[model samples]
Target: MKCEYDKDTESLKIELSEEIDMSTCKTLRNIMDGYIIKYSPKECVLDLEKVNFMDSSGLGLIMGRYNLIKMMNSKMTILNPGDYIKKILGMTELAKDVKII
Candidate 1:
């Protein structure tokens, strides 16, 4: 996972690799949470364009971030998720909680 924050836009973009599972979820969460705390971005964008697979852990990650951003009165968006990822998001009803584009 990669994280980038734009001060001008007050947005934080997180780019995930092809796969996200339990092995990486904890680390990813720590890093993402740290960045959020440090920057306090108004918008959080999860770039899933490169992600082809994700497990339940990935869903948890998204939900966790969604709640975190909401607590700050910020918004979270899932960007360009692949078909598989999109389906999982839909199945988990996470698509309704966050904007997907």
Candidate 2:
């Protein structure tokens, strides 16, 4: 995963990889957690544009980030998720908590 913070928008953009599974999600969660704690961005955008495959761990990561943002009184958005990822999010009803765009 790659992270970029925009001070102007107070948004942290996390670009996830093509495949998101247990191992990758773990590392990504850690990095994102730290960034959230440190910067306290008003909004977070998880860029799933490149993610063609995602397992349960990916859902976990999204939920965890949603909780984190909620705790900080912020917002989280899932950006550019592919069809498969979007369907998964829809099935899980995660869009209720985080915007999917």
Candidate 3:
């Protein structure tokens, strides 16, 4: 995950690539949490344009971050998730909490 805080937007933009599976999600989650805690951006933007594959762990990561963002009175946005990831999210209720673009 590549994280940067945009002061203009007060958004912490995170760029993710490769696979978000069990093996990588753990590290991804930790890194994301650290960024969230550090920046506390009003909008947490997750860029998944480079992510080729995702599993349940990826969905879990989104949900976990959404909850954290909400607790901080912020919001979460998901960008460029692949079709398969969109399908998985559509099948569940996770989409309700996140704005996907």
Query: Can you list the residue pairs that collide in candidate 3?
Result: none
Q: Candidate 2 — which residues are off by over 4 angstroms?
A: none
> Relative to the true structure, how large is the alpha-carbon lDDT of every model?
0.88, 0.86, 0.89
Model 1 lDDT at residue 3: 87
Per-residue accuracy of model 1 over 1-101 as CA lDDT, tens digit each: 78898989999998888478999889888988998889989999999988877988999988998889999999999999878778888987677778999
| Superposed Cα deviation of residue 2, candidate 1 (Å) | 2.1
User: Candidate 2 on 1-101: residue-level lDDT in tens?
Assistant: 78899999999988887588897887788888998898999998889888878988898889988988999999988889888778788877677878888
Off by over 4 Å in 3: none
By TM-score, how accurate is candidate 1? 0.92
Report the backbone clash tally of model 2: 0
Taking all chains together, each candidate's TM-score versus the true structure is 0.92, 0.91, 0.94
Question: Which pairs of residues collide in model 2?
Answer: none
Best by TM-score: 3
Least well predicted 10-residue stretch by lDDT in candidate 2: 85-94
- The CA-based lDDT of model 3 is what? 0.89
Q: What's the C-alpha lDDT at position 18 in model 1?
A: 45
Per-residue lDDT over 1-101 for candidate 3, one digit per residue giving the tens place of the 0 to 100 score: 68889999999999998598999988998889999999989999999999989989888888898889999999889999888889988877778878999
lDDT of 1 at 4: 91
